[model samples]
Target: MTDNTQHTAQHWVATDYGDLDVLRLEETDVPAPAEGEVTIDVRAAGMNPADYKHIARSGDRDALPVAIGYEVAGVISALGPNTQIASGAGAVGDEVLAFRVAGGYASSITVPARDVFAKPAGLSFPEAANLLLAGTTASEMLHVTGVARGDTVLVHGASGAVGVSLLQQARLIGARVIGTAGEKSVDTVRRFDGIPVAYGEGLQDRVRDLAPEGIAAALDCVGTDEAVDVSLALVEDRDRIVTIAAFDRAEQEGIRVIGGAMPASATYRDGVRAHLIRLAGDGDLVVPMAGTYPLADALQALELLTSGHPGGKLALLP
Candidate 1:
């Protein structure tokens, strides 16, 4: 067994507030898990636009050296006394996935065990790592909008990570999804049982044509002027429309907007993690894999993530 007391890990950090150039990889000591914590030898780290977005928008100079990445899947290397995983009891060597943790873009990480749950055996490390972040976001979006069986949801940016998860999750609950995507992602939309609608010119009219009875809710994953305009035009009930993006438009237009940074959103997302884990483990929900990148190539992976055509979920293999 590897010595648990000593671990030298390579992790990525942003030394300043800027773009990818601010990201610097440096070797650091992995401290042993403290009270109510666990140390993980990370096999895979989930990548999202938020990973880079947070860094790019960092105006706080004091928080300059914040670590990157939010979720990871790996084996527990060490655990604090009297601590238990969120799913229940756990031990060193147990395979687990953690979300909403910091510094996950590393070969190893020590995080509060409360947020960690056992990785489903059916899922690969990367898939498990990719599961909760987007799943929970999709869940929150649907929850806020009160999406239910037989209801129709209008999803903007249905081909992306959150979008794909939204499509599948909505499908599982018997809600029909009319998803907006580029011409290339029509198959991606259909594969997840979503009705594909191409974005751009005539988007509003096309969505109207697809759901003439009217959209039950509009979930905006991509914050585009077009999405906001179309959603406003189609959905009569303002409170039923929500956005994870389009924060400014949501404010100006009096629509709902939620993000991980918000306390209420964080609480809701955390509360639903176990459910999402169960869904993925039971094979009811499948996270579409876009691709993986080496730990050293975080920038490249993030570049693809920001490209707006990631195809599906992306991960960093540590």
Candidate 2:
């Protein structure tokens, strides 16, 4: 087992919901696990677009001083009493990954055993850190859309983490995949075995030419109005179209949406988490992390995220 005390820990706290300037790096007390929980000495943390969106736009300043990260990959440090995680697959010192209910920006976090998963043997800490939120969201979309053999799937923002994941998972289900991205990311979408199409102006023509017969289902990982418009144009049924972004607008457009902070039921989250673990272990999933920033430089990481077009997921290493 590694010596847990020899390491120093740091956390990023956002004093108020604003820009990257709002985040502060501070030396905080290390966390301890409660029963049914395990404390992880965080090695890496993954950033999502929602992290910045929530900080800038969510307007609920009541949760000020909130830690700002959602996914982490680390080593098991301490475990709470009566926790199976302490004795099961992950004992003290085992490498692990977890999706936080909150507080993942810290150098250490206490996560419920159910929300933690054993990191796959060949995956690095940074790679595993990129999986949780985007991977699970993609899994859920596939399930909800009932994508099946011979179906033609269309994914918007195919160069992004969720879009790439959707492309791969849809392929695994025996579906033909076509994805939209900027012209520069066309190669990346093609690398994922998806037919690549450009995402602006003439998007409808590009998608129609690629799918030919029809697109059985569509997933919008990018919330652009163009993405929504193209999906509605190609798919005959609005129910078969889903958006991870544009939740408020999806309702108005009559398209199905998922994963906004709108009180998602526990059952749904559990099912999605299960699918993620299965796909990761079976070699059916891939999470591309665009870049990494030192934990102390979280502000820079947020800056990169806010700049947009990261090309993939962004992460922080402690």
Candidate 3:
């Protein structure tokens, strides 16, 4: 009898940047762990716009056949040499979730041990896979802007995955959040402890009415010009205004931008992953799931993400 775990694995890859047609499913040998790495039998993979956007934005990149994925949750199947150190190494059968990994859209993956964390009991595999990126981004946004207890902040796209995380994490920090959302999503933002304000013309005045003292900080998850303009007018200090979506305008407007694509921004997100995992496991943070798809149908998942307003995060189940 042969070990099925060592058999070929199926995964999605982008040979070049293009539309949904660019994503192709392929089979390859199951990966073996190198030093300080662990192989996981993936149960769930999280989907985000960044996954597709990263490919679409690349122009004639040298790397061909790039494995496309960022986050996954699964059980450890094997550990690499010298990985057992200080009782921190993940053992076989350990349920774990990891972020910032390549080739996550597969039945199994080998990732660095340092990037893996024990899956929080309070969350299912899908939620655990979804937790790290948005949660850490929210945490970093709050930290970089100095949002504290008794402070009021503005969050654009409050009902989005990252926006919802922002609302929950900001409330956890004891800050009051005034969030911009569509008319239909007002209650969704409110449910996350955010005061929802409709996004449209006169958004600045509406936010001002809600926060008479003015917002201490503003975070734009939507990356709209309106959001940036409103944030600039309301916040006294430009440093307190940040955009995760509008990186190009950040320098021109003299406001900070935190994005995974930016070299300087990774430190803020990487530093907070462990703390975010703890918070989610403790039930202080929640990651809402919009939908889940079989691994082979990842094209539909990417299409749904690009469609916008899916109401929550999408996950891939192998």
Candidate 4:
């Protein structure tokens, strides 16, 4: 920040709203953080499907060339006057992680200090960068569904990032989880202590075979009708079923849907950041990373993400 004009950064942006082909790796001036903000020298950027989803959905020319990526783990390169991070005071050279940030797919990012947090020593940069978004989402699903100790919950797409988080967090809450995964992902579900049931035509019967005691709630991380139909059939209490993606299905079926885009969900997710990060620090929660790619290979990473079998979370090492 000593010489504001001298700082520059390489970042990913969607010059137009479309597919991955429209994205460009471009250089831009790194602005000095304004009051209550700080600039970070990013070490890693977390990858999520949401990152690419935004790029193709803006549908507005004015919002063209929007920055991509939402979270990062990095070092504080500069601090604004009187800036304080989400956890407390921040300092230059402090290792940190930030969520709800723009342009995180970069070598550096300047973001609001309010979104920055002290990175846990137990988490590597890749893990720290990938924690908050999915972790918070999973936490909210469990919270809204009234998942409690001794409760058995069914999670669709159990091997996904959010599902993995749900399994770990639910374990901490003393709730037993029955998770649905592909044959290849069965071990991953089991690794997280979830009863792994292979998902397909016989998913419901398979789930019933594992949890004959009855499922107390259902979490739909996958948007398939099978997820919705099975959840509706198993959990008579519609209030106990929730989906993060199937908005229309939720409306039709009267099941709940939660995401960062919803006001209540956003508030809850933000409020839980401190607690979730602490859990990661204490090793009560583990972020399973399937892969990491160079910053410039964000598209390739996105391709794997789009493949719907990433195995776990993905991160971009900058």
C-alpha local distance difference test of each model: 0.91, 0.79, 0.86, 0.92
The digit string of per-residue lDDT tens for model 4 on 185-231 reads 98999999999988889888888888889999999999999999999
Off by over 4 Å in 4: 1-6
Which residue pairs overlap in candidate 3's backbone? none
Model 1, 1-318: lDDT tens digits are 223486799999999988888899999989877778889999999988888898777578887688999999999999887788888888889999999899999999999989999999999999999998899999999999999999988999998889989998999889999999888999999999999999989998898888887899999999998999999999989998899889899999999999999999999999999999999999998988988999999989888888877878888997
lDDT of 3 by residue, 27-99 (tens): 9787677777778899999998888887786765778777888999998888877684112656888889988
Note the residue pairs that clash in candidate 2: none
Candidate 2 lDDT, tens digit per residue, 1-318? 222343346788888877778888887766467777788889988888877677776566687887778888898897776665512566888888887457788788777887787787667788888887887788778777888999998998888888888888888889998898777898889988999887778989988888788999999998889989889999888888999887787989998888746456235655576567667777878777688888888877777777778778878888
lDDT of 1: 0.91
- In angstroms, the error of model 2 at 40 is 0.5
- C-alpha TM-score for every candidate: 0.97, 0.92, 0.95, 0.97
Q: Give the clashing residue pairs of candidate 1, or none.
A: none
Root mean square deviation (Cα) for candidate 2: 2.7
RMSD of each: 1.6, 2.7, 2.4, 1.3
